[model samples]
Target: MAKEKKYESELLITRIFSAPRELVWKAWTEPERVMRWWGPKYFTSPICKIDFRVGGSYHFCMQSPEGEDFWSTGVYLEIIPLEKIVCTDSFADENGNVVPATYYDMEEDFPLELELTITFEDHNGNTKMVLQHIGIPEGITQELTKQGWNESFDKLAEILE
Candidate 1:
């Protein structure tokens, strides 16, 4: 039997957008705007189902440029309109069943889900967005996951632009 791995970490990413807070908030709360820039540059989210309320569920499918598909689902734990959202994010099947999410090619020990909290603050005409990703695997794999997230965020900036 393989030894079980114990790993934990958290990631914080902050960005300032030159847009009104309400518009920036809408880009995240609205499914259509979300789908436009939710994944990496080479990936596109063709399907997104969102319910903007606490206890609601959101499901989406990201298609890679090469035709590969990945599904993600989450349950909203808390929601403050145009302010903050807290949820659990996880990999899922096409039917929205939670499954193991392979991070950085790690075949074991990675958490099946992550608790994410996102906040949007209005700073004059700029929107300050903060994303907190908790439950990250430790060691070198954490770096890879971080990189992936940065890339995804870059895509989001483009979508918002």
Candidate 2:
């Protein structure tokens, strides 16, 4: 049999915060904390909701510096407390209804749904978080996602501090 093909994510966001694993997980799972650092620089997350369990859902809205609003929703596929989280992320309306990727210009080649696998590891007393986004084509989504995550992580670090 031919070797099974694997889905290699072209976009990955990794950050190690000077905080405990549990605290790092809380920053991701807690809507209130997520609202503090969930968008790119100059962007703000005015709304954030997280169920934070297997099969549960999360939704949030990010307002751009230009005042345009963008919403994103996700369903948790797997969760291991402070260890790992797998979820499906997509553009959505305020009602949490999934919309076309093109609606947000998130992707041009890949499907609307993006798979995100986030892992948190304890590095001494700090937390190492890795966010791997699967199905990110070589386009705007990749750059925008990276920029957003990086900005978010910076905010998270400040929060942890």
C-alpha TM-score for every candidate: 0.87, 0.90
Worst lDDT run of 10 residues, candidate 2, spans 1-10
Show how many residue pairs clash in every candidate, following the order shown.
Answer: 0, 0
For model 1, residues 6-56, the per-residue Cα lDDT tens digits are 215687889887778888888878899988877777788899999878998
Over 4 Å off in model 2, which ranges?
A: 1-8, 105-110
Clashing pairs in 1: none
Error of 2 at 60 (Å): 0.8
Which 10 residues in a row give candidate 1 its minimum summed lDDT?
1-10
Candidate 1 positional error at 75, Å: 0.5
Residue pairs in collision within model 2: none
Each model's lDDT comes to 0.80, 0.84
lDDT of 2 by residue, 20-82 (tens): 898999998999999988897888999999988899999999999898889999899999878
Best by TM-score: 2
